[model samples]
Target: MQKIVDTAKGLEGLKRQWGVHAAGVILSRDPLVDVLPIHKREQDGAIITQWDMGACESIGLLKMDFLGLRNLTILDDCLDAIRENRGEDVVLEQLPLDDKPTYELLARGDTLGVFQFDGGPMRALLRSMIPDNFEDISAVGALYRPGPMGANAHNEYADRKNNRKPVVPIHPELAESLADILGDTYGLIVYQEQVMAIAQKVAGYTLGKADLLRRAMGKKKKEILDKEFQPFSAGMKEQGYTDAAIKTLWDILVPFSDYAFNKAHSAAYGVVSYWTAYLKANYPAEYMSGLLTSVGDDKDKSAVYLAECRRMGIKVLPPDVNESMARFAAVGQDIRFGLAAVRNVGTNVVEAIRRCRKEKGAYTDFYDFLRKVDAVACNKKTIESLIKAGAFDSMGHPRKGLLAIHADAIDSFLDIKRNEAVGQYDLFGDAFGGGDDAVGAGMVVTPQIPAGEWDKGDLLTFEREMLGLYVSDHPLFGVEHVLTAAADMTIGALAEESSVGDGAVVTLAGILSGVQRRITKQGRAWASATLEDLGGAVEVLFFPNTYEIVGQYIAEDAIVVVKGRVDRRDDQPRLMAMDMSLPDITAADEVKPVVLALPRPGARRRWSSGCARC
Candidate 1:
């Protein structure tokens, strides 16, 4: 384990492949060429050093770090939205750190949009620690990382923090010098600044020399330790401390120097974490609007954050041509989906729509929009995408009707535009909104819209196809609740393979689509079907034997619960069915009895042959 850690830590310097600091800008009194070798960053074409910040610092040059944080941008967006929608300038940075509501929200682990505190393990830690103050929030961020996390450090720190474990020091005499710095950290050596402070106070070393001591300890060099220990022990002896006291304190420092976080950096990040939690607690809609916008292009991440928004009781409506913006927007207390998320809906189309809506109030109907909107921007493909994403749903037309009439609408609008260019309008009529007199022989035609919704499968498939996810409803919405509770793993888990192993048995409930069946070379029958639920999708392959047994259920748009082995041999893993059946809610009592409990543990279940279907 120690070797593994050292190997992982060694890669930190090489991870960027001989790259320089992200925002390090070095200023020199002399020409840059006279000081060091330089090159432009490959990613952004900025001038940078061939050596890292440490090497530059050692060579007597100043390095300044200017980092652009995503959380700051998220906060800025949230504040701007608040000012626009609610007419109040919310000064998040100026808010008090002692807010009870923020702490309570943190305790519930509802920090989906918060910086540095939203990981699964960190959320669990927050739930257990129940942070009541700002200091604890900061400490969790500093301690939750991989390097500093081991040997029950989290438990020890949390226990000591909440008074479940007593604080103890290396020596009773050292407590007076250490209490001010480490009292809040449960006497644990959590920061490099504390290492410098302890070295100065206990060993009579000057602060500058103590920093060198800090460096020597961090490197774990045997020669440097041999050269430095005599001075450290001699200074402590002069301070009237015994030899045993010196060893006890020095022993703790040895392991700590490996990964002790810098105090200033940890505190800064911790405060940002708390600030984001505060924003999530107070202005959920505005904060999630920015959060959704930041990850709009990524389907999986968008799904996760949208679920978080729902958990916060913030409704996420589908895109609306009448009211939607280019990016996600806050509509009173809810977040309105953005048009940019729809697949193939280009930037020009969104801009044209926004411009038209801004100049001419909300769109009256579909045909009205097509007549005035730019035909170059609003083409067949763009119109189809808009309809599939439900942007026209608010205009009193179902997606199917709009999809069917999109080409007709665009053609009619373009014909009118060509005639208007040719001077076809009535000279005696008003320029706009004067009924039939506005155009000499022209008439506005509204497309006929049916009164019923489309087939559930078609509606959801189109939504998932164009918007990257199912917004109105999932294909398996009817029995998903019962099947999800009874299944071994979800379709999402099988597709993502988050923690499932190759060739492991699993059970899932999903709407089957894209069914392909054929006769094998040996004259046996086989089939493959795509089973998809809201979170994700996976392919279920039925070999001859299983296909013969479940052939009736292998069809598009049919929801089935299946127990299978995840076949990881393929480049993209697939599920090989072991057993299958239609989802029957009333059979929960019968199915649970036969479902085999595999060795896999916790909320995620892996299956075996004995596992039964729902």
Candidate 2:
């Protein structure tokens, strides 16, 4: 208050804010004279003084940031999932930078949790402009933006990577100045470091000055840029560069400066990209688990993650109370769906279930669970959500049975406890001790299924309804072989062979994992068709032509084979189905295994012994 009053009394436009200044305050042998007459408090038999940041800095104290980046947490979670799933502790930091699979992942746009590639548009860009090298990853990280979305940049990038195009030199003299920065990115200014290096090499700018200019360009200050340009041009000519070459290079470099991305930032994110690639290539199950685990409470995200899991052929098992943690967990390679992901199933409820299960064993049946933690963790709505989510199907009941009986089961459970509390215990006198014969123990009063059981399709659909995904199995598992010969490829292999404009006629058979649609700029809706083969998954592009014909077959988890060209648009590749078929599995027949016979050891010896006589 006194400082504020003093600042208010100062000259006009004082601009007083909390500021730190540096000064040396020495302690004398006689402690009283060296110090100012100010309030002092002792701290553990020591004097404590508060100093501001600038004061500390001026006094040569170093500042270190304890930065907790979200990416780091995500990285940790991803690694943890990988470790749990793969049973190997992969040190992501130690991965080789030039991994083929890592580059391949970028090329294919399988960029979920892949550092800077996590955004929808970024994935689309990666798919369209398949990055073939770490430098491509870095360059894309830098080059992709509103301003730097250069004409034919994606094509140029792809061509350069495939060695179909040369790394063009903007200026003959500046070749060495740009070579290292360009690396495999074909002489593009895709990193701020490149700009800095260019400034240093071409115009003799100090690193500090280069950084300042880079910042000025990013700020897009006309006056500052104009002032800086004269020195830059003069420096260029002094180095014996022609005026025309300098001007041309300057035009390219100046525009790039506006969004000249940081190289360190790109490198850091590239590490995450590489880590995800390594996981996808070597430890897919763990990658899927982490991917699914992180999609907290988002059915849409989970749906996408699940589709990726299926695409990767990583099995996502239904949420088993016994196996499931509050969050999604990896049980072997299978992602045990998270209880927290179910609608209305709060974290607290999940914690309660976790605690109850820890105290006891896994709920023997749904009723065993209901008796102990149901009232505490689950309400009618919570139970209903769990039913709809299929968290209880493992309790020896169809999902419909569980869903139908939830109210009666819950009410009956409450009534039984109430009766036992009141004086009605003798009516259900302990047939055995310790309430072992309790009404809801070892048996739950579920509604009866009709005479016939649910068909495979219905069962899968029920699981899908609850899990926000198909977990038990894909709908098209039976037609996997037929689909394979038709498609002539595995999902993992599709991206390996195709060129940017090349297309392959294939028959892809799989269960319809999911369909996501979006409107293009001109208001035309385009859809992405996700299908899961027995081996893995392939994404089909539903162009207006394909969607009009096969859209209905795709909406259900039906067994369908799509005949289409292997589509390459963005660096990513997927099948754009032009034809669809649903094959019948019932018409197929099974055959028995054949066994070979061998002589017994003693008989062989006898035969050998008798051979001379024969």
Candidate 3:
């Protein structure tokens, strides 16, 4: 036992391995090779320093972080889209900070894709705070973390900002001195900058010394804190503050410094949050087009955004080979889905299709499309995927008919190309002649199959399979009334933290998707699935007990009504399903009373006599 303890202690602080920081870089005026050793990472062949950030800083080499944020890219894409579609240039930096519509959108908790303000808890806080200016946005961003949230600082800020609670000072004697520093945060020490400001203002510490004190408090450096305590109290006393006020001010700063965010960082994020909100409120379709293109490869995120689009009264049309670009585009009051977002479609094929469309005219029909598209890029799988995703719907042919003849069309085109490659004569020999004019004339004889359209369920299933979502229609289309009548609330409504309390019982109905069945350690079956309705989707969990009764009904594409309790254990709410059932629109068991009108006073007596005789 003693040897094991000594061995563990010896290994505790030893250098185990070498790794690189994700975004940190060391900047120096001198040559890097002359000052320190460097090497390239094996994965991407990027140069990295031999020492860590702290070592570089200790050696007086300046270290900086260059963060790459996807939201920033989304903002750029949105602005570019606005220019292309609307012919109007939008500069994000020049946007008005006091935009009324932006604040209204934020206050309504409509920030599904807004940066830094999309989470459920953050949205709830925004609704409560009703932020009217940029400062409130910055303060909300700083106060949303674990430290401030744990201390109920977020709720207190909301209440005080909304005039429901009073903004009390840390100490009466120091209130006037600290008011200017803490005024924006409603007398709460929400930022590390505020702590430094307080130290400089009330305790008469120099800027450099106050910054040191802020760092010491944030890192909880006991030695430095103890060393600085005497001077801080003495400075306050010299400023005519009493001992009690000094102690009270110190008490609040100690714990808050642990998680107080930097004001500059929070304000920067607030700028981005406001930009997204502004664009979404004023230019929804254009902004959503860029937003969708940004996350085009992520199916779940695309679905969430599509639901938001629906809520905003913007129609998202399915991918059309004649209309879609490589990325999602915004039409007038609508968004056209991008072809690159299709499951089996590749970028090469998308580029080929676009190039062909731009050079030649629009595809007259499915046959014309096969003839015009690049044979090498648009192969069997690509054509089939495009067909199934409803990309050919605008060519005036049903997806079912296109699916029926797409294989033969591809094979025939390939055969003709093969014959041409071998220097053989044309197969049709001027009957179906070459050149763009002949091709236009040959459209009359294009092959047409007499296949019927698929049912709504099968059509939507194919769309979902190919496009990763049901674009044209959903499975719960006709039965919405039944689901609404059975469900206690929509899945979207349940997503709001204030709409339903944790562990509160509620009923919901939607089509089950992404169902996963698993077995527990005790060999009992459990399952999880995403219940998606018109508004949105929610995760539903079935434990062993509930699974016994509901497992049979839980399957992919099954429309179900789930009775469950809200599970708010995670950032998003989930459903702990207690019972489940299939929606039954045919079931009518209600006993509604029938009323019959009597024309005369004796009509009731005559009807009764007639009923008795019968």
Candidate 4:
């Protein structure tokens, strides 16, 4: 007995590759021979260990996959928004799977906030499929995959929901196995659990053995499958299932299991998917706020989110040090833009401004604010960035004017604050009362806005940066009529056009969305840029265009109109820009400021606020 035990232990201790494995001795440099195989590759100069479950058991090692995920962040934000808005902290685990609002949202393709199912194709699928329950959502989530090529899953789901087809079961035993899933997609084999059930019931395999088979099937392992299929088939035959029926079921399953998604994984993602849907449906303000806040640094995404908010009739207010928070904040249905998102302005500046406001109330004006905070914290570049981003719009200064006086204003503000702090009062301090006298003295050096000088391009640029989308007005304001007549299109009409020929001669107007740089084969830089209108986004190509035109206007959210013909470069239809210019695209060829007729006092303020969203 001792000899037998020793022999078994010795054989188990052998490392086969690096040394020898003759006569169970494992004669190697080390007595405790390393049984695990060292993985080697030329491309990446390292020996990787192949120690997955099967590899571990064979080579006497252990292995586990450590997965980090982003869905948790989505989960956290959803719960926080829910708690903050409704006073109800929802534990998604306790929420019913059959949520009506969730399904309604899925049906409408308003899955922007949804987790995995937020893609363009998925959104289109949701609009058509019209899911009625959580099971439908889960099944759609599982079926709307690459396997169902050309949107077969979406079509199948939509057809089943509209009673255009009957739900069919593959086998009698599968009736019970597929009953729960059928509630949504009428017994579609859309989940891994269904596969395991079929294996367990039809093949008479134990759950553990079935799981191994499932894993083997998922991995498409030939050797393990060859070892397992005989018993599986024999067990099914013993249960009186005909070979033809078995083959049919197996045929349907093998392909899907080839891409068979994990039902557990989809269900977890569905929770976030449902939450985003719920947020979009129920709390547009808070949802937009969080969405804007999360993507503040990503100008492209921020602009897109702003467009979505506008479509939802939610306003995105411009940044004001007094009125706006550092992060996107909800002001009724409107989302106040984040100050931290402005280019060149560090997030620390936003936090400092917010801290100053919280410590003291709303700032009285420029001088009052300068007294509390250091102007040096926001440097020239930072001030210009904020000015371009419309951070001081609420101070009643046009962006151009604010930028013009930025340096002098900072210097005078710092001087006044320093003097005030040291109790150095002016000679006439108590003459008209101390407060009135201080205000009058400060007023002399304070920056002033010119009465009639709001430039159209500047307005659009400022609004574009602050609101994250073109609001206040589009750059092609007067040119929209021309674009409509010339290209037979508006900003909203681009998507309907076919991707054929040289496309259309589109004269659409938009804020210059972004410029993406790439190096050509000749090692010269070229750019593919985006121009966004109120309608949607259009891609534009600029090979040598950036050099001729002003590059300074390419700053984040600068409004520019592209008068280029539409063309398809790489299968995707895009605008091939022949000419691009700033907001003054008038045939007159001169920049001009906008003139407004004054309304009654009440209507004047109202018009100004409404214009903020134009």
Highest TM-score model number: 3
Between candidates 1 and 2, the one scoring higher on TM-score is 1
Candidate 4 residues 70-175, lDDT tens each? 4556456545755665676767667666766667667767665466765666777776677766656666777777654333555776677766776666667656
**Clashes by residue pair, model 3:** none
As a whole number from 0 to 100, the lDDT of residue 281 in candidate 4 is 74
- Residues 1-614, candidate 1: write the lDDT tens digits: 99999998988766556645667788788998999999877688988777778888888898887899988888888888888778998776688999988988887776766898766666777876778887787677767754457535676787777677898876887888789878878887777888888888888899998999888987888898888889999999999888888998887777677776787888899888887888788888988999888887767567767766765678888998888888888999999988888888888888888887787667777876776566555578888888888888887887877777778767766666666667675454466555332422246465676567789778888887888777766655445567777587655445553458897888888778779999989999999987776555678889999988989878888878888988888767788998898876665444443444323121134343335553
lDDT by residue for model 3 over 1-614, one digit each (tens)?
Answer: 99999999999998899987788889999999998889988899998988888888888999888999888888888888788888999988799999989988888888989998877778888888888999999999999987788778999999998788999988888778888988878888898888888888888989999988877877777887787789999999999999999899887887787888898999988888889999999999988998998887766668778888987899999999898988888888899999988978888888888889889888877877777777665488888888889998887778888888877767767665555556664545566566433332443344666568888878888899998888887777667778888999888778777788999999999899889999999999999999988777889999999999878888999988999989999988999999999878554334233446443222457888988999
Which candidate, 2 or 3, would have the higher TM-score against the true structure? 3
Give each model a TM-score.
0.79, 0.61, 0.84, 0.69
The most accurate candidate by lDDT is: 3
Which of 2 and 4 is ahead in lDDT?
2
Q: Candidate 3: minimum summed lDDT over ten consecutive residues — where?
A: 436-445
Cα RMSD for candidate 2?
A: 14.1
Q: What residue runs in model 1 are displaced by over 4 Å at the alpha carbon?
A: 1-20, 40-44, 52-54, 171-177, 237-245, 421-447, 476-484, 487-614
Q: Go through the candidates in order and give each one's C-alpha lDDT.
A: 0.77, 0.66, 0.84, 0.64
TM-score comparison, 3 vs 4, better candidate: 3
Where model 4 places Cα greater than 4 Å from the true spot, the runs are 1-99, 148-154, 171-185, 221-230, 376-378, 416-444, 462-472, 476-528, 534-539, 542-614
CA displacement after TM-score superposition, residue 143 of candidate 2 (Å): 2.8
Q: Rank the candidates by TM-score, best first.
A: 3, 1, 4, 2
Poorest stretch of ten by lDDT in candidate 4: 19-28
